[model samples]
Target: MSPIQDIQTEIDAHNDIFKNVDGNRSKMVKSLGSTDEASFLQQRLDDMNQRWGELKAKSANIRAHLEANAERWNRLLALLEELGRWLCLKDEELNKQMPIAGDLASLLQQQVHCAALQKELNEREQLVSSTLDQARLFLADQPIEGPEEPRRNLQPKTELTAEERAQRVAKAIRKQAAEVSEHWERLRANVVSWQEQLERVLDKLRELEGAMDRLELRLSEAQDVQTTWQPVGDLLIDSLQDHIDKTIALKEEIVPLKNEVRAMNELSGQLVPLDMQLSSITTRHLDDLNMRWKLLE
Candidate 1:
């Protein structure tokens, strides 16, 4: 299946899941006939909460992917615009250098200007190609290398007679002119290729835009589902809070009672030692009195 179709299928499945959850929630709410029914409702709510969390995570991932695609598309579009502007400027410069009709010096000057323009164009093309390669690699999640050094054509020099030197100069000029013509032809071909590539990029941009729209719609629906579940979640939270408050109050009521019992135990321990001392003193007094009675007898 096509990618769009696959996305639609996934969306439909999610919608079905959402519908099932909603139906289960409604049924559970209506059937609150016993504690078990309430427990089941709570369980279902927990499950729905987990599902909603999963859906939110997935939605974030989709948004991130869309953002990355958008960045790539924008970069590609910017590159095309820059290239178009550069081409227009170069064309204007070339037009300004056009040779006047039937003027030899003007024609020669134009030829020289053409040669210079060809060299500049070659350098620009190389720079543009490198930039495009890097951009492509970036979008593909690949490593990008540094720009390569431009290649140079080297001509060997030789010691020769004046006639031979003149002949070599003439030959070199003809070769240079031919090279310039060939470079111009390549530039024209490259322009055509760029146009075609631009069209392809535009088509891809449209596809991405459509995908973004669908994702946004899905996100909105998911938000609505979340909103619907909010009240149930809030009710559960409030119930838990009430239980917690009751437990705290019970603890507070028991603490002072526990402290009073501990204090009474400590007082009882102090009384036991005093009672032992009193019994010893009474026994000693009785012994002394019996001794005194024996003396009297």
Candidate 2:
């Protein structure tokens, strides 16, 4: 027989077994009519009917609980499906991106977009986590329905069954949650790394700018001193050593600035065109200063 037909047949058999309960009780009451034991037997029948009603109430409660559980499961599946789809889309978008690179203004704009994405990711991650928590709370409930004595006997088995079902769903949820979290972490790490890189580049650019400015200013000051320099014969006898030491001092300063120019030049190619131009200008300035110093020395 088909499963549905077999189930209907079983239900029909149960109905047949109980179909004569009311009639038998009535017939026995009539048979014992007017006897002192009649009242006692009637009372027993009434009590049995009350017990049956209570059982039916319990059955109704359990049915309602099962229906509610089904509804919750539906909602959980819908939410998980929605959350998973979003995570997948966002993950794909992030994967297609290369590292943030380019000029300062462009990198800064990318940094801003990365920050916004990071914030959105945090909010969505929390929503996913909250949905997972709600699913867990719903699954934590048992769906057993019956009298205490009978249900107590099967309580362990029922709990184990519920636990088994919950564990199965939990496994799926956990896997999805892990995948979602993995996506979030990967994206967040990318943003952080890109931001860090941008910061380093900007910092390097700033440092190079400062070094170039200092070198230029020192060269200007040295040129000024050169203009005031006196020839040995025109200087006092003791001022000879002092004038010679000025050239030595100037060389010492130029040596460090030359090294600074070289260092900045090496890094400029990897940075931006502006940095390369700045380095180039500084190199020409240093070359001019060195030539002037050589003639003076």
Instruction: Give a tens-digit lDDT track for model 1, residues 63-146.
Output: 455555554545554554566567667767765753221222333455556667667777877756665554444434421223
- Total colliding residue pairs, candidate 2: 0
For residue 290, give model 2's deviation from the true position in Å: 16
**CA lDDT, candidate 2, residue 106:** 54
C-alpha TM-scores of all predictions: 0.33, 0.50
Model 2 stretches with alpha carbons more than 4 Å out: 1-17, 20-23, 28-41, 65-73, 100-106, 122-133, 142-253, 258-297
| Model 1 pairs whose backbones collide | none
| Best by the lDDT measure | 2
- Candidate 2 weakest ten by summed lDDT: 142-151
Candidate 1 runs further than 4 Å off: 1-9, 16-19, 22-56, 68-72, 95-104, 134-297
Clashes of 1: 0
